[model samples]
Target: MSVTLAVNCYERTYRQVLAPGYFPAIEQMNARTFEQVIALINNVGDPREAQDRAAALVDCGEITGFEFVSDWVPAALQHWRLGHRHFRRRPYLLDYGLVMPLVSSSEYILGWDAETVLEEPADWVSPSLDLLGSDSRVLHASLNWPPARPQDAGVEGDAVARVGDFLLSWGFSDQVFLISRKNMLATDMKTFSPAAIARHAPHPYTFEFRMESYQRASRKVRATYEPVRYRTNLQIDGVLDRTGKSQYEGFRTEALHRVEYHITRQLPSRLGPRWARNASISQARGTKQG
Candidate 1:
């Protein structure tokens, strides 16, 4: 018999809490630009005709280059808006969710930042396999895309190798420090749990990445580097359990056998250590209580 997967569609928003001041300034600029573009869209007698005229102007070379301040904003916004609308209405709906199971295990990729690799002393840098590998100094990757399924059995070393290769191909990580896996599910699909969703919600602020700049030393010069820290807030708006017929009125029966991946980067990490630590801790505490 075909297996059933309880697919959850989530909306994720990344809020940058701690970063260089310039980052927020740039965000404000972008927001203002977006508002101007929306005003232009509203001013047109016919938005479609305006888009057609813009395209024709481009084809005739009347509009040759973009001016970030004004010229290209309308076209870019309209293009993205229309393209996303078209994608949502398509039959395949792969962008909406996964149709086949892409990941069967939960794993994390850990390593040192490039700055540490290039500048820090070898002894000062700790490998991820060490007891203190989970230290704050280590870089932990966030796996948000292609949401992973819960593995019921311990992941083998070979399986980790394969998953590591997959992550590399997708530009997720360059190095793997350690692989941590757990058998959390007892069956293929579990009943929808609101408690589970609530438990997975993000905390106020978490480290995202560190920015660094380096200057090489010459014959009469000295080497120097500067580091800037950044933290992120993951806001989970809501979740839709598409597997239930009653909950999802238009649920497709054919979708039962297929697992949805929810390719949109909007889906938060369900597997990696950075995000799943709270859930794992709760599970451990629950096991002790039992």
Candidate 2:
């Protein structure tokens, strides 16, 4: 059965409080108390006033404990920590606050074109892609690795190609971009240990790929292709290490790896003149390319 809650409550509690920068903590409460708290927060006009009221409930034993939400923490750090926990076990109820929206929106795209899905551990690709249904097409997939691979020639290309071939077997004609650093430097590592060497290396490149699927020429070919345009950003960036030494002392940085696949589907043929014109243009291009 699908979980259902009041829309306003979900937005205020989950989306607002649990959003990046805020850490939401709630004490144990029964259904009635939970609803009351939600109502109280909803009635308040100022964010700080709402927080203060919620804290008051804790002091009165109406709620056991609660933390006023604050945006002091970085979203990347929270996502990274949550990612570690997600891999260890099933996602917690709070984690659903983030996952549900992602899954829901991807499932909702019926027309108009363009959708992006980001996965942390490459393992999420299959399950997330499975939810896209048959109408959407994956344009590209990227895999990132720390600069710890053996210095063998063509290893990166070979690894990426193997993954590309695997995706092809899954009926996707998507391309794969592999990003990894080369020529490791001694200064990049804190120790000579294998684990440290592997963990501390930075990414070598950043790239973005966009793919568009156009209608086919013949009726037979048209049945196989969808009118959609997709754009994907697969890149790496330097992230500040919050636990590292202060700025005055010299801050530490780490690589933030991301894999995003975007899917865009065109409107049905009967939608409007605009779609009809675009489809015709796309078909001509497809025929010429073919």
Candidate 3:
């Protein structure tokens, strides 16, 4: 299979939260995480040696290409200024992510966030791709479903079952999945329509769009899920200390708190009418809103 990995690298957006005065420290953290991901990609094989076998999917011919997608500097700045009001709140979600398969020549594409690193030698993508072999009914399959907070585990499971046809999770913790160009087109992944973007403004950048698309697709297709191989460590963006729980975890927690406290509580008002600024206000409450 001609498989490609499309990674969404939003370095500019990573540092967008830092005001001009906070550039020195914030830039360093951003650069560090960026370099760390690059290094992880390089060291994917070295740590385990793969028993002298092909270590990376790249080496084994499972993933034939790597496309690093990001917005241009001008566009990034405008989007930052425009915030979440213009098109989609998280433009990178659709711009750098969902659009990958549509633009690629490869038959299969593994969409991933830059923060997600590969630590295992298993050909996760190829196996998932093989599972869908010649089965046009299978629309997409999740590569991993990382655990959510212990307390909310039950709620999460219920939500997954509720939307089993169109899976949803607490954002990034469960988004990694493998998809085909055919499925992408079938789900209308190319153009993120303005009306749809407005309706999903609150959680625009997450997998909700894809899930909804799948749900809306022909009823004959099926979606599959798999246990996560790992939680996939996060690169703490702006913290200097790496001795304990990641700063990324801290950042993610805070963001989720605000989402729960602000967005969820006020979804009616937050996503009121046609992409209101109230939602923008909720989205811009302190810590980075990636």
**CA-lDDT, candidates in order:** 0.20, 0.23, 0.38
- For every model in order, what is the number of clashing pairs? 2, 1, 0
Write the residue-wise lDDT of candidate 3 on 41-66 in tens digits. Answer: 21131323421222243444333333
lDDT of 1 at 158: 9
* Residue range 1-290, candidate 2, lDDT tens digits: 11111111222243343232221122111011121122112222365655665565555545333322222113422532433333222212122222212222121211100112222312323322242223222222233322223563222321211222222111111222211111000011111221111122221110000011111111101111111112333342221122233343232223211111110113343332122212222222112110
Score candidate 3 by TM-score against the native: 0.45
Task: Tell me the deviation in Å of residue 251 in model 3.
Answer: 20
TM-score of candidate 1 versus the correct structure, residues matched by position: 0.20
Candidate 1 lDDT by residue in tens digits, 1-290: 11111111111100111112322232232221111110011122344554554444345443221111123323432432323333223212222111111221223212211111222212211222232233222122222121123452212210111222121111111111222222111111212222222222221000111000000000000001112112222132211233222423224322321212222122233432222211222111111110
Compute the lDDT for candidate 3. Answer: 0.38
Q: List the residue pairs that clash in candidate 2.
A: 114-264
What is residue 38's positional error in candidate 3, in angstroms?
13
- Per-residue lDDT of 122 in model 3: 41
Relative to the true structure, candidate 3 has a C-alpha RMSD (angstroms) of 14.3
> Which prediction has the highest TM-score against the true structure?
3
**lDDT, candidate 3, residue 52?**
25
Model 2 clashing-pair count: 1
